[model samples]
Each structure stands twice: as C-alpha cells, then as structure tokens.
Target: MTDPNKSLWTATARPAESDETSHETLHGTHRTDVVIIGAGFTGLTAALKLAEGGAKAIVLDSVEPGFGASGRNGGQVIPGLKYDPDQVDQMFGEASTDFIGRAADTVFELIDKYRIDCSPVRQGWIQPTIKQAHLPTLKRRLLQWQNRGCNAEWLDADRMQKLTGSPCFVGGWIDYRAGSLHPLNFVQGLARAATDAGVTISSQSEATSLQRNGDNWIVKTAAGAEIIASQAVIATNGYSGSLLPKLRATIVPANSFQIASEPLSESQLNEILPTRAVVSDTRRLANYFRISPDNRLMLGGRGTFSEPASLKDYGKMMADRRMLFPQFPDLKVDYAWSGRIAMNREHLPHIHQPMPGLTMALGFNGRGVAMGCSIGGAIGEHLLDSRVRLPLPFSEMKPLPLHAWHPFYATLAIWYYRLRDQLEN
Candidate 1:
C-alpha cells in the first residue's frame, strides 16, 4: 500500500511531528458522559462540541486522529448535498435546503473560532460541464439556489473559459459558499481545539467491543483499556470495519485517488485556474481539482476499490490534469494518494440509532468535509438535548443485499459510468 504520509498535504500541513505524542494510548478504565470511536472529523467535532457544553467525552482511534479520509480529502469544502436545492426540497423539505446550502458555514465558523491555519481560500467552487446536454440541469440548479438566497452565479462558456482557462466546458456555475483548505491542518487543528476544550482523545486505541451495562455502555479497547459512558457514537465513516459488521454493510467504501503536480510557475498558474477556484464537473464520477497553497495542481477522482500500489494507479488522474490544462509547462507528478469515500444507495448522509444510547452517522458520499463537521456538531447538540432538531433524519439501517460482493458490483458500475461519460462527449 502507498504510504498515506507521502501525500502533499501531510508534508505541508500543521500539527508538528512532536504533537503526535500528545494523543496517548488508552490504558486505564475511564468514565465519561460519552465515548466516541474513530477520531476523524466527525468524532473530533462532536467531542469538541460536547466538551464545550461541559460534558466529558472520550474519543478513540485505531490509528491517530486525521489518519482517515478527514486528512486525505481533496480539501474542496463545497457546501450542500449531492442533490440540488429543488430536489432537496422535494425529498427533505424546504428547511433542509437552507441548512444544507449553508453547511460550509460551519466549517469556516469552526476555523475562525479556533483560529485554524489551514490556508483557507473562499474564492468559491466551480462546477463546469463538458457535456452540453447537462446545461439545463445546471441552469435549474443555479436558479433554485439563487431563489433560496444562496450566492450562486451562472458561468457562460466565455466566463467559464476565462476563469478555468480551458475551453472544454460549455458552461457551469460557481457557488461562493465553497472554498479550499489544507485538510490535514484543519483536522489537526480540530484535535487541538477539542483537547483544549477538555475532550480526551486517544490514538492507536481501537474499540474492540461494546456491551450495554445497566444504563451505560462499556467500550473495551484493543490495548485492554475500558471506557464506560452514558452515550456512545460510531463516527468511523469509511474506515468502519468488522467491529460493527452490520454498520459496515450499510455502505460501500469507494477509494478516491489524487495526484499533485510539481509546483507551477507564476505564468502557468495564471494561465490555469486564474481565479484559484476549486472545480468539479457534471459527470457520474466527477473529477475534482484545485490549486494547492504551494501552487501544485491537485486533481482527484474515483479509483479502484482497493488501496493503490504505485504511481501508475493515478495515471488516469495525471492524464486528466494534462488534458484539462494542456497549456501548462512541464508537469511532474510529485505525490499520489488515495482515500476511501463512504457511499450509500441514497447518496445522502445517514444517521441511525440501532440501539439505545448509541448514535451513528456516515455515508457522506464525496462531501464529508463540510457535512461531517456540520452533522457532527448537530449530533452533539441533539445528544445533549433531545429537543434539538437534527439536520438529517435518522433512518433504520438497511444493509445492502449481497454486500460482500460490493467490490465486483462497484467495478461493473464504474465501467458503465466511464462508458457513459465517454459517450456523452
């Protein structure tokens, strides 16, 4: 497997190497108001909120915090869900559109409150379309969001070409609520903030088992440590495994691969993505790309189901970048990495309560960064007060049929989508 630490973000982000020592392994029995498994964005954000509310919370991760998708994402903090505003209204009610539209606000708010230095750039996110047939959908999407008071703007072919410095897109839209950041730094900052607020986070401490004991839940760690708490949260998104077989069966972990080009020259940068806006496109398996703080062209898209083995695994991504910006100077691949995305059939973030005093949320599709923090904070609030409404509705867990053969099914699906995308062009 490719070392995740080899990624460009990890090499440049904050939370110095010495800071890893702060997350000690859990070795003793402890008591807290709540115990959370998987110290990624969701777990850390929830713990931070609970601690701020004067509740004792303990977070345990098999590896260190930010070792999962939280630190490995493309860092484009786009707001809203997979559906557009009108679809959100028809499916989840009108109120949901407003909340979902501003989901990125939570990310920026948290960054500002904690003073996280994650190279935040609110230049906006562009969704350009290479397929002309998709223009009507983009039009409706823009109109609906604008009607809801969102800062969404339409981009004609000329405007799109001017902004992206590419003539491939016929048209697109830009959502000003979106932005990019150093993902590793943002998650590490969350850890620091959560610890400052009195949340106990343990690294290399896996929750081996959980059993109900009277009114509390007893969680045993791999290192023979124990934690008894009144509430428990399963915040392990794409990394959730055999520890909870049923939960793992509810979603497919799709791998996303990314490659970073060598830092671009000032002239090259000006000729490509001159506005520095993060971009994605209108395709079944969309390609997302951004300009890194160090000026590297970071492009990403879906990958094989398994962990990547070498740079060749990202060959398609590198080719895509070159095709998008052929005017660039010599482009060299400096980094290649992959992260799993939790995808469910519904294509929405799902919250579930399978048992008493236990809450679980996962399946953010490709929008985990903003949704994870927003939904996590809401989960924390709901746990503190039942009357507090959640941004998403809780549904019963329905494990996908033939879950074990998901790899085969996902591969076939990817092939179909790839063919469809090609045919559309």
Candidate 2:
C-alpha cells in the first residue's frame, strides 16, 4: 500500500543536486536588481532568465524550491490556458490571445534548450470525452487549436479507447504539442540553472511584509532580513499569504489531490495507456492521469476545497481513480498527496501590476505547469526592458466578491460540478 501522507514525487523522485544546496534563512539586509517571492517554477524561471541577461536576482521562498504546486502537480505539461481559444479571444482580444497562445509552447522549448533532465515525454496530451454531451466541446476545442495552426486532431470513440486503453471515454481530442514531465525534477533543474546563472536563492525566508522606498521596494522577511530591489515579482500563486492580502484575495485556492499506484507489471502497463500520452477527461470535476517514467500510474483530480487533514480524506479521489482505470482492479496505491490550485473567476491566468515596480502573476486555474514557466519568462523580459510587451494582457488587480467565504463556496461549487458531471454523463 502507498504511504498515505507522502507525495509520490517527493518519495520517489531522484533528488536533484539543487536540493542539496544549503539555503540559509535570510538574516540581514540584501539587495538585488529584482526580488522574486516564491521559488516555484515561475520564480525560478524568472531568476534564470534575469541572470542570463546579466541582472542580479534574489529569490525568497517560505519553504524549499518546488515545494508548492510546482512540485505537487500532476506533471502534465498542457499547452494553452484553461479557457478555449474563443473564450480567450472574447475575454482578452485576438492579439493578446494569439500572443499568449504562442508563448504556451515555451515550456518544452525551455526543457530542450536547457537540457533539463526532467524525463519529459512529448507524446502529446489527450482530453477524452466522458459523456456524449462532451463531444461538441471537444470538437470545438480541437477546431480552435486547428485554426491556430496547432497539430490538433479529433478522435472518435474507437480511437479514444485505442489510444487510452480504456472504454471510459466516448471521444476526445489530442494536442500534438502537449506532453508530460516529472514536475519536481523540472523545477529543481530550473533552480540549479538559476543558481549556476548567478541568482541567489534563500529558502525558509518568508516575506512577511512589503513596503515601497522611493523607486525601490523593501520586502521584509520573517527572519528579520529584507530584500531591497527596484522591481519585485510576487510569484507565490496559491500560497500567496498576508504579504499581499489583496493579491491573495484575487484567487480562490482550491485543493487538488492525487494518488500513485505501484509500478505495474510490464504486461499490464502495455495494456494500459499504451500510447504513454497524458490524459484527462471532459468533466468539470475532471480526472487527469498518466503512467509515470517508472511505470507507476498517477491519477489526480479535484479534491476538497480545503486541504485534507489526512490521506484517508482522499477516499473519494481514490475511488474515482479505480472507477476510471478498472483495468488496474488490483492496483496497489503507493502514494497520496494534495496541493492547492489558484482558481480565478475568469478561468484564466492573470497578470497584474498592483503597483509600479511590482508585477504579480497567478491564477493559472489548473494549467500552471507550462503557463507559469511561460509567464515567468515574460516577466523576466519585461523586467529587463519595460518596453517589452507580455503576451498576457496586464490588468489591475481585482479581488473577488465574497472572498472571505471562498473555502465554503469553493466546496459548494465542487459539489455542484460533481452533480452536473454525473447527470450529464
């Protein structure tokens, strides 16, 4: 049986050399060209890019790098935003959508360019339709990507079954450019690259407050250390805390839980997900899954609105996994864990400048793995040259209504979605 408490990635992943680096807690004043709060993919990528451009960067995180959603994610490198192309264009206009759409491809490019050893398998991503009613949206989604010159294709029920080795899906679509990777390894690799590129990373250095000093910002840490920088990037995402109350209020942090089964026998593996492509379903409370590099089946989905008190609390998720992959009827789960996803009302990643000399990017919905890195790169470019326009349209930060009741409402919303999915299917 899997350890109910440990994250599969943390328990099984080969430790990166970056993890061995001794990141002392911030204890004194420090200065850098840019201060990045949160050492997740976004901050690490931004640090790497800024260092490459000869800019000095100091990264501070409450915990170690990749300790948040960046490491705990399902590891699916899905391209594009949570919204469909038409919705994106409708919300942000054609020019911004086109620009952001192209930037979504940067994740794999970065992996290839940096030679990051994240065990990336670029076989594409499949979104299967769990209900006949889902076929129209799948077809429309395929057309949207096809119109953008993406190598996207729609698949009939037989093709979906053949590709996924399951009959649970009626039909689906595949995005040829999408793929999967060991997300923890990917983020750790970025940290190593950032360190090698001369960026200073300090862990266990939580930013407790932020204050402006003329053209610069002074970020105070819990350990009495402060980072003075002309520019700052708040990349905390779902972990955003009191350092910026308004920013935290802008996102509803929803918990996502995942479980991994013991490595399957070669015969069983071959009979399941033979294409080795990452897969997710069309339900609002969808399930995403894939075979890990070591042949373990990793299944994940929306869990409780708040963090579950224990792995036993993931009973629903575990049950859902078994239902989705009945071929593994005797599967032995090896790990279970959960993390928060920053959900925006618009169902899209948000880039905002709440104040001058400060930039904030969060709310990727559930598509953070690839989009976070892409947006981080854009932030780096913007920091280097204010004239550089980011693909994501910048907007003023607007806190959601009834932000204080987010946990209650988020739980209620999940229940509603689950009911809708059940009825639709």
Candidate 3:
C-alpha cells in the first residue's frame, strides 16, 4: 500500500503560497532562542506564544506555512473532538475533563487575541443522522452534553429536514460551541502575527538533525543552520517521524480526503443549506460537508492510501451530496484533495519528554485546530516554565510499537473499516 495521492483538501482551498515561498533561501547557519519545526497550526501557535512570552522563536518547515493540513482543511472550526464529552471525560480524569472543557472554551480566545480572520463563523455545528439506528445514541449523547452545561440542542425530524433540506436524516443535534473558517487564511494570519512579533520564521528549511549538547539542545537544518537553544520542542506532529527519533511511533498517520463543488446559484445555495451549518453524519467512516461562504458544497470523508488517482472521486462525492441534500445534487464539481492526521491509539493528544530539555507533542487524533493551538501555547509555557505544569493530556511519551507489523496492521485495519462502513447502519 502507498500513501493516497488523491486528496480533496489539496485541490480546492489554498494558502497564498507565493507570499511565503518567494522569500530568500537559507544559506548560512543561524541561531534563536526557540526553533519550531513543521509550520502547521501547532508550530506556528507555539512560535507565536513563545514570542509573546519574551522568547525569540526560529520556525523552520519543509514547505511554507499553511502548506500542510493547516491550510488545506474544509474550514470548519467545529468544537470538541471525534469523541463525545462523556467519552472524553472517561478517558481522562475529572480534572482532565475540566481542563479539556476549559481548553475548548479558549479556541476563540486565541483567535480574538491574534485577530485571526479566516472567515470565522462561530455559528455552531450539527451532525445529521443518515440512518435511524444512531438516533437514540445521538440523542443520548446530546442530553449527556446538555447536562454538562453545554449549549447543545437536539432537533426533531421536521426541524432537521427543514434545516438540512432533506428528509433522509431522522434527526440531529446542534452544538453551538463550534464554527468554521478559511483554515489557510486563519493559519496565514497566525504566521503573519508570529513573524511580526519577532519570531524568525523560515520556510523551505527542514530540521535535519537534533542532538543534546550538555546544557543546550542543537538542531541542524537542511539549509546548514545549527540552532542551540536552552529548550527544544518537536511540534512536527506526524511529519516529525524519522527526522526526530521515536516520533513516528507516538501516533498513526490516518489518510483523510475532502472535495469542493463550484459555487451554486443563489437559489440553489439557499435551497441546499440556508443556515450554512457544518455537518458530518454518524457513519463510522462518515462524510462531513459544509457550504462554503461562496455557496460551494465542500464534502470530506474516507481514508485512502492507494488507487489515490481515484480520489478525484468527484462523482462519488456528488452522488452522496445529492443523495442526502438532493437540492443541488447536480452541483458542479471543482476541487478534490487529501492529507494525513496523526491519530493516537487513545484518540487523545500526547506530550512527552524525549530527553530532559526536549519535549514531544503530537496526536490530536484529528482535533488539530483547537487542540493544536491549546497544545502549542500550553507547551510553550511548559518549556518556558521548565515543564513544571504539563499541558497535554497524556503524561508520558509512549511510542507506537515500531515493529514491522505496524503498516500491515494499519492497512488491515483500514481495509476492515472499509468493509465495516458498508455493514454499518
């Protein structure tokens, strides 16, 4: 099996690449107080917070900022995680639960502080029911969340049909805590802010080697620059693999895809999603889609590693779009692409100390937006504060078994999911 070449997120939304790419190249060695790898959400957030806390940050990436999932996402700042609140509460202790709940409450806090304007639409999120089997479970989940002081509302079938413009959904709930954004623009804004704050950010430069040197940590880059900082952070997430030792085993790289449609006519757009709430269904392997600010239907779901050429499955995306929405089943196809996320075994964020002065953070399990920002900022404080207070959920860094069976096991599990999706109600 090979990595999926076809991904939808890559095709439609894009960052202002020329802005970051055309900058001068790195030729000589440089130094800074902090060096951040992988200019995605996590790295940029860390850089910004580090700079804010009176530390100089040097950020390096294999590509420009927002070149990865940070820019290519469907732009939904949906609240919470793939897991329900109760599940999250159970996974972590009560204090951890409170910490996570408070953490999510601060997503917009960073946005407001940084003045990020990626077309933020804090209009909340919904999970439309594609079948009846999940109605009860979803309803229970809704009440569970509501009981916890959450602003969640379970709509009746009539409301859901009217809101979704389709009778296919039996019913669904809306969590008012979430919203959407042009992720690329949001990430770009973060990068711009970090740069302005004196963070020395360099694109197209990769961290080639990392080692310990007594009281300092040394980082060598492909551009030949060596950074000796009092502390080091491995914020590369999934991409941190190989370049940073034991980084790959801490998480699983799940392949995710997305597709976007050409903007619909005004009438058709209103006919489809008038309220413009983001949506994902209850399927184990599910389809998550939302109407863009310009009225395009952006849909994402499915994992891929091969036959990637088929990811341009615009036809399939449209079929499902029409099947559920039906109003604009005929919407014109436009963009398609995919990317990878670091999914942890526990489906929670992980942070650990690879060495005394070094730290590792990864595995948002797909909640990169809020969790990434929270982790980045919090970990920045952790490093600056000498790791006195841990910021992430997992206390220890447990590497995924690097046995030869990993890829095989992952592929088998994905295949099993493909089969299970068919059998899932």
Candidate 4:
C-alpha cells in the first residue's frame, strides 16, 4: 500500500520542505554540465558547490529538497562517526588519517560560514555512559580525539548528572564544537541558497533512470523530463533507489522517530535541561534529545512498532522520554515525525566513483546534516580538481549481500531492544 502521508511533500513547497512548485516543469528536456539526483543535503550541497565552481548543475528531486530525512532529523551537527577517533583512523590507511581527522572539524565550519538559521545553538553534545563498563570506551575515545587535536573533555558521574539534571547517566564527554539546528529550516535555507548560487533545481522531478551516453550521462524522470550532463553525482544516499544498486546494498535506510512537547514553564525548563545541551546515551540502539527553542523537549528514539496515529499518540512518546528525565514524565507533546537514516554496515561514510563520470556520496548513519554539508563541498571541489582530498578514505564497495534481510532484521532488532530495555536498563 502506498503511504498517503508520503504525498505531503507535494504540498510543502518551502525550502525546508522541498517546495519549488513554482519551477515544476512537466514534459521538458534540459541539459547541464552535471546532473544530480536526490535533493536532500547531498544533492543540494553538490548543486550549490558545483554551481559556485562555474558548473551548470541541474538538480532533480523526485520530491523536493529537504523533503526526506534532511528536513526532519534531530537537527544535530555532530562532529564524527559512531566510532572512536582512533578506530576510525585505522579503518582507512595512514594516507587518509589526516583527511578524516580534518573532516571531523570541517563539518561544523561549513555550518558556520553558511549562516544557516535553523535555530542553531552551540550548547555542546553529551554522550552519557549507558553502562558502567562503557565508561572505559568513553575515556578511550576522549583520549583518541585529544590525540587527533579534538577538544574533548571527560566529565565525571557527578558532573554529568548535575549538567543534565538526571541521574540516568554514569559519566559522559563534551565536544564543545558540536551543536543542533531546526532541521527543516536548515534544509530549506540550503536549497534556497544553492538555488540563488546558480544551481538550477527542480522539484517533483523524480529521476526514473540514468544511463551513460558517449561522454555524458542522461537523467530521465517518470514524466519523460530529461537532463544530459558530462558528469553526474548520485547523492541519493539512503534513497538511492534504482539509480544505483550498490547504494541499496551498502547503505540501509533505517527509520527513527521524534516527538516535541509543548513549551514548559520557566521553572520547568530550568529543571529539565538548564544548560540547553543535546544528550544521547551511549547505546548501539540509542535515544537522543535536546530542549527546543520554546523549551519543549525534542526526544528521538529507534524502537517504533507502528506509525503513530495522531498528535496525542505523539505525546505518549514522553513515556519513553521519561526513561531519561523522570522530571518531565507527563510532558505534553506538540508535534511528532519520523525520518529514515542511511547506515553503512561499517558505520563510515563513503565517497564512491561507481563508474567513470559518476560519484556517489552516502551513508552518514544519522549524522547526515553536518556530514552532508561538508561532503557536498568536498565532492564539488573534487569534481573541479580531481586531486582534491576528502576527509574520508572512501571507495566503491559492492552493496549489501542479502538485501531482503533488512526489514526483517529491523523488526526483530526493535522487538529485541524493547525487551532488553525493559529487562536490563
């Protein structure tokens, strides 16, 4: 059954929601220097950067820019991968070490220079230790980041509880460079800015197929709209679809849900997250949250059994939120939505040169906001100068071995975690 809520994109034509209803061209053929697929961050970033470099990039989105996860995420601007800095360095050879290290810092720098006003707040990030044994891993990661010139400081258990106003965490670490944003607004701003920078963007233009012609590639839409270009960058990531099969195997699209509560009183806000810091417990299956601008707690989690029915059902998400903050156990949730994230089994981002004249940037594993922004620029520069180095040591690898296992594994995993969360934590 087709999802009716999925068509909501057709109406939301804002920069935040993939609005470009004004430029929806039907039954037309166009040509450009480069054609990009998927208007989420990757596609938008590629378009913006390529256009600024004097390349005519025709950005085609099946829906609209920020229509997908790019617009509906937790708005976190986290610095690095889900791995320790040293472990990340060892994944790729020594030659890519410095590049990966620099990338951890550059993601935030891109967000700053763009002046993206998605309610960005530099309140820092806290990775609260989920188990007592996890404290060693946290300490090891901190030292690793410090060795790589990252400004990370380990917080004791007392300090962690005091800062968070919750006794759920054993210890944590603070990366001062990390922050958060209003996701939809941020994506909208990026699309608008890139369009203003000379990138021709088209919404409602779903890419149906891609084929290489002599020296260029042709991007065709279901409506028969065509764009021919010398180069193509598939930034579809989690939504790569048939445009690339390898992406489907290597990047699995997983969903996470978020619920935002009605604003709290001044006293209530201070008692909840006084410092305004974004927090996430250190778990393979994790819960992430932060205080919204209006003082509502925006909480995100992974184990959603069903698509919530209404706003009232969204409020029930607070029951899960209370697992961390007992203070706001009965918080009134105002809005709720879910977004899909692309996770590489390896948990590292990839830059793929799948075929000649094609490059793919994908797999942020829920950290796509900052990762996508920086990768867009990195890919644009590389397209401009082939010798340009990226922060990640990436290569094109075959897609997942058994694709059908994803949905089943996803369901079973969620069920297992719910049981574990009930019994253990």
Q: lDDT of candidate 3? A: 0.71
lDDT scores of the candidates, listed in order: 0.90, 0.86, 0.71, 0.74
Clashes of 3: 7
Specify the highest-lDDT model's number. 1
Quote the positional error of residue 364 for candidate 3 in Å: 1.8
Inter-residue clash pairs, candidate 4 = 13-19, 15-188, 16-188, 62-206, 249-400
Judge candidate 1 against the unseen true structure and give its global Cα lDDT, from 0 to 1: 0.90
lDDT of 2 at 347: 84
- Which candidate, 2 or 3, has the higher lDDT? 2
- What is the Cα-based lDDT of residue 379 in candidate 1? 87
Task: Give the Cα-based TM-score of candidate 1 against the true structure.
Answer: 0.97
Residues forming the 10-long window of minimal summed lDDT in candidate 1:
13-22
Model 4 bad stretches (over 4 Å): 1-23, 93-108, 305-316, 416-425
Which residue pairs in model 1 clash with each other?
none
> Distance from true position, residue 92, model 2, in Å?
2.9
TM-score for each of the candidates: 0.97, 0.96, 0.88, 0.89
Better of 3 and 4 by lDDT: 4
Expressed as tens digits, the lDDT of each residue in 1-425 for candidate 3 is 12234324433344555544342446576667777777888888888888988998888887778777777666666556666778777776555555565554566776788787666677677887876778898888788778878888998888887676676878889888777777777787788888878787777788888888788778887877787787787777756657855677777777667767776777867666568777777776677878876667788766554424653544555567777766555666666666677877777777877567776678876668777877787777776776556544445767778533566788787778768766757
Mark the regions of model 3 whose C-alpha exceeds 4 Å error after superposition: 1-25, 102-105, 310-316, 386-388, 402-408
